[model samples]
Target: MAETILVTGATGTVGSELVRALINRGVNTRAAVHSIIKGDRLRHFNPEVQLVEVDYHRPASLPLAFTGVDRVFLLTPFSDQQLIINQQLVDAAKAAGVQQVVRLSAAGADMEPGIQLGRWHRQMEQYLEQSGLSHVILRPTSFMQNFVNYQGQSIREQGAIYLPLGEGRMSYIDAFDIAEVAAAILTDDVAKHHGQAYTLTGPQAVNHTEIAGIIGQATGRPVQYVDVPETAARQAMQGAPQWMVDSMMELNALGKAGHLAGTTPAVEQLTGRPPRSFQEFAQEHRHELMPA
Candidate 1:
């Protein structure tokens, strides 16, 4: 029988794609979602994907979620209790006889406290490292799908993309590529994979204005880029909590000053394919942005 790998945050961007890649390689995937309602789509996406209710906030669900699972992919919704939730996952993974674990962390996942996600993810990485399970930490840069969130309702009405990030360059990585890398690490046992973290980014660096230009051209619409102040950016975000506001602003400030603009071939090296360019991403989803 094939080993079963349990994936947390199964309905999320990377988790959704990660599950597919694992199943393609003949790995049995069990998706631990917060609720059965969210797991329906993942089950439809993969016949082999088994959905189970595993709420991280309530650590009680984790043991049941990890039952008979050999490998685990952990993802914490970045927030105040991230460290605590991650610790719970580590304990549960260890208790449930899990052998390998993969973590989806943010860029700059080091112990240093320069960035919020960095500090939190580093703590989680350290906990998993000493948890007696083989682990791979994926520190991916700014997600390109963050742009997709803007296209949802407000930006479609306003014909513009708003951000606190001015003309700062960043290698915005594709979430699918991140997932592909995560899937590879979870399945294989390369020496370099253990006790190591990989920083994943796109092939090239570009600014928010350039992203706007791509979106404008791709959709044949007049799209504008407006650099709002951090205060305004926070107010503009719908349903954004106070913590998310702080993190988003910090990331924007960091990117605007060119602090997160590292290009890498690691994604391609691990996945055996180049990360998707903004042009390709735009072309594939142009219809969604410009529905007539």
Candidate 2:
């Protein structure tokens, strides 16, 4: 019998790509999405991919999704409630007798207890370890997809990338590569990766100025990276909850301190290939980054 894998956050950036990768490998895949309507994006894989509704807050809804699932790919959206939500899923997975769990976490998750996101992920990591289910914790560096998700409008309208990162260099990995790594671990022999924590990073580290140059070359436009003071960034993000603003500022402070810089071999070690460079990512998504 083939292993049946359940993927939570199945319509998201890494989850969506992981679903495709699993399907391509001819694995038994179930996509646990929040809503069947929004999951239509994954219809292309229908018949081959099973779609199930999952509500993290409501623990009662998770067991049915985990039925007969051999392993799980867990991802909870970033928020104040992430710890509670993921704990709910972990409890559900344990109850379902799932064999393994691969969690998508962030860099510094194990090291920086003071960072809000890192703290939350570490808490979940600890819980999963104690849950008695075999687990793989993937702590990937900054995502290259931030261009599209967070800074696309600024780049398109002003030809600039604005952040409070100062001159901090980050080895940002592509979301697709993170998915690839997850797929590899999920489909391969589970014993090799169980109880392991891997930090994923791109092949090279680059600062915002270098990224701006790469974007300019890719889109054939003059793009600039403007470093704003944390205070100015906080003012610009006015009206967002104070916690969110503080979290963003803390992350920037970490970046500016060179804490987020450096490459890791975990991606290559796991996938047997080097992670994608930011230049390649920018080039591939140039049309999207280019002014509309």
| Highest TM-score against the true fold, candidate | 2
Off by over 4 Å in 1: 190-192, 237-240
For residues 160-187, could you state the per-residue lDDT of candidate 2 as single tens digits?
Answer: 9999998998889999899999999998
Error of 1 at 98 (Å): 1.1
Task: Give a tens-digit lDDT track for model 1, residues 52-138.
Answer: 998776788888999999989999876688889989988999898888888888887773567775776777888888887888888
Worst 10 contiguous positions by lDDT, candidate 1: 149-158
Cα shift from native, residue 133, model 1 (Å): 1.7
Q: Candidate 2 regions off by >4 Å?
A: 45-47
Residue 132 deviation, candidate 1, in Å?
A: 2.5
